[model samples]
Target: QVCPGVTPPTGAVKVTPGHSPQDLALARAHGLPLLSVIADDGTLRPPGGGWLQ
Candidate 1:
């Protein structure tokens, strides 16, 4: 997953531990946001809170 302000290289794909489709689907079904990193204040990073209701 990409950091809040970090730039990833071209064609870069952040593969975290639970990036599988099954895991994603499961998290989606449960209304949970999938996250790889968080802010220093404990806030979920981008692409993470989107799944939250």
Candidate 2:
């Protein structure tokens, strides 16, 4: 966990596994920065029409 008054290194990327639209919406509503990452055909994908559907 990141400590208060401390900053992570540059170009740091944080990911949340198994994220869904409802989860994304709720996170956004609460002003949380979240990006959906999904697994497809042995690869990872970002949020899209198929993800939302």
Candidate 3:
């Protein structure tokens, strides 16, 4: 599906496997890797780092 106000040939949805259940299911169906970016304390972990916090 195309997003409103988005031009043709450039429409895409970003899947956040760690955050959304739907995205996680999509990722799993597509054999995509699941990455953890948030820690138990709600802090950003490695790879994401403090820059994103």
Q: Which ten residues in a row have the lowest lDDT in candidate 1?
A: 8-17
Taken over the whole model, the C-alpha lDDT of each candidate is 0.61, 0.55, 0.83
lDDT of 3 by residue, 1-53 (tens): 66777766585679998788999999999999887877899788977876775
lDDT ranking from best candidate downward: 3, 1, 2
Q: Write the per-residue lDDT of candidate 1 for residues 11-48, one digit (tens) a residue.
A: 54444436588667667786775667566787776666
CA displacement after TM-score superposition, residue 22 of candidate 3 (Å): 2.3
Give the per-residue lDDT digits (tens) of candidate 2, residues 1-53. Answer: 55555465355434342356676666667677655454656455655445554
What TM-score, to 2 decimals, does candidate 3 have?
0.66
lDDT value for candidate 1? Answer: 0.61
* TM-score of each prediction: 0.33, 0.30, 0.66
lDDT of 1 at 25: 69
**Root-mean-square deviation (CA) per prediction:** 12.2, 8.4, 2.0
Going through the candidates in order, what is the number of backbone clashes in each? 0, 0, 0
Q: Which has the higher TM-score value, candidate number 2 or candidate number 3?
A: 3
**Number of the candidate with higher TM-score, 1 or 3:** 3
